[model samples]
Target: MTKHTGAWSGTVAKKSRAAFDGSNLYRRLAVRLDDGTTIDVEVGRALWRELEVGDRLVQDEGGTPHRGQSSTA
Candidate 1:
């Protein structure tokens, strides 16, 4: 068996919608990980506002990291 380890972080590059009735919209959260790999987090439009550029997110062999705010200082 093969185990899937989802590890990456980028930033939000773009966002879009379909009909405007809040039906088929996607919030693409781009992440630039420490390894230099970019990961795109395709979530709902309602949740895109919570993320921004330079926001750090980490995930290792354990599990997904908490979707909380990051510190720069």
Candidate 2:
């Protein structure tokens, strides 16, 4: 598998229900990258709860996503 490293900033454009595995629901986020390209990221229910449409997201190269602070000053 290809590993992505470093931090990337983007906006959560949309979300969708990915799968239901017995107890947990897997969710996918469509993030619009800073450059205008979009990427689909699958995350667990816990992480999914923290994300919302239009929220700024910071994803580490390790594929971990976090809620990012606003860039507007």
Candidate 3:
């Protein structure tokens, strides 16, 4: 996979967590970007808690994913 350059903006498709060793203890917030191409991004627990499906997500080059102006808003 190549490093993402510039910026990418899209809607949050879904939220998920990884389960390891049959234990959900290793849980982490994950989301699949619904841009033209699918991309998986790890989001912080704090931010994740505030995110909901369909929210706008934007990340710039060498930047972090953040909640953008929601279309619904």
Candidate 4:
């Protein structure tokens, strides 16, 4: 798949849920965009480890598409 390029700024709204299946830990992050929209994201364990309640994310847009990582979490 082709990748898009852009970055967004948002605050961590909440930590949704952290789930693990035999092999990996998928973490859910709820972030609030500057406009006040809340979005949830499914992050790989590695990336999730780097995030926290207030830490910011500077991710590649293609890495997580369904969650609209381009503009929010």
**Which candidate ranks first by TM-score, i.e. highest?**
2
TM-score of decoy 1: 0.50
lDDT of 4 at 1: 17
Candidate 3 lDDT trough over 10 residues, lowest sum: 24-33
TM-score of predicted model 4? 0.56
The whole-model lDDT of each prediction reads: 0.51, 0.80, 0.68, 0.57
Q: Of the pair 3 and 4, which is ahead by TM-score?
A: 3
By lDDT, is 2 or 3 better? 2
Full-model lDDT, candidate 4 = 0.57
lDDT of 2 by residue, 1-73 (tens): 2333567889999988843767766688888989998888776788788888998988876668888997887
| Model 1 CA deviation exceeding 4 Å by range | 1-23, 59-73
Residue 42 Cα positional deviation in candidate 4, in Å, after optimal superposition? 0.8
List ranges where model 4 is wrong by over 4 Å. Answer: 1-7, 18-25, 59-73
Winner on lDDT (1 vs 3): 3
lDDT tens per residue, model 4, 1-73: 1222444457676775533566755577776766677667666666666666876554445455223243343
When sorted by lDDT, best at the front, the candidate numbers are: 2, 3, 4, 1
Instruction: Give the lDDT of residue 42 in candidate 1.
Output: 52
Ranking by TM-score: 2, 3, 4, 1
Higher-lDDT candidate among 1 and 4?
Answer: 4
User: Candidate 3 at residue 33, lDDT?
Assistant: 55
The model with the greater lDDT, 2 or 4, is 2
In order of appearance, the predictions have TM-scores of 0.50, 0.76, 0.68, 0.56
Between which residue pairs do clashes occur in model 4? Answer: none
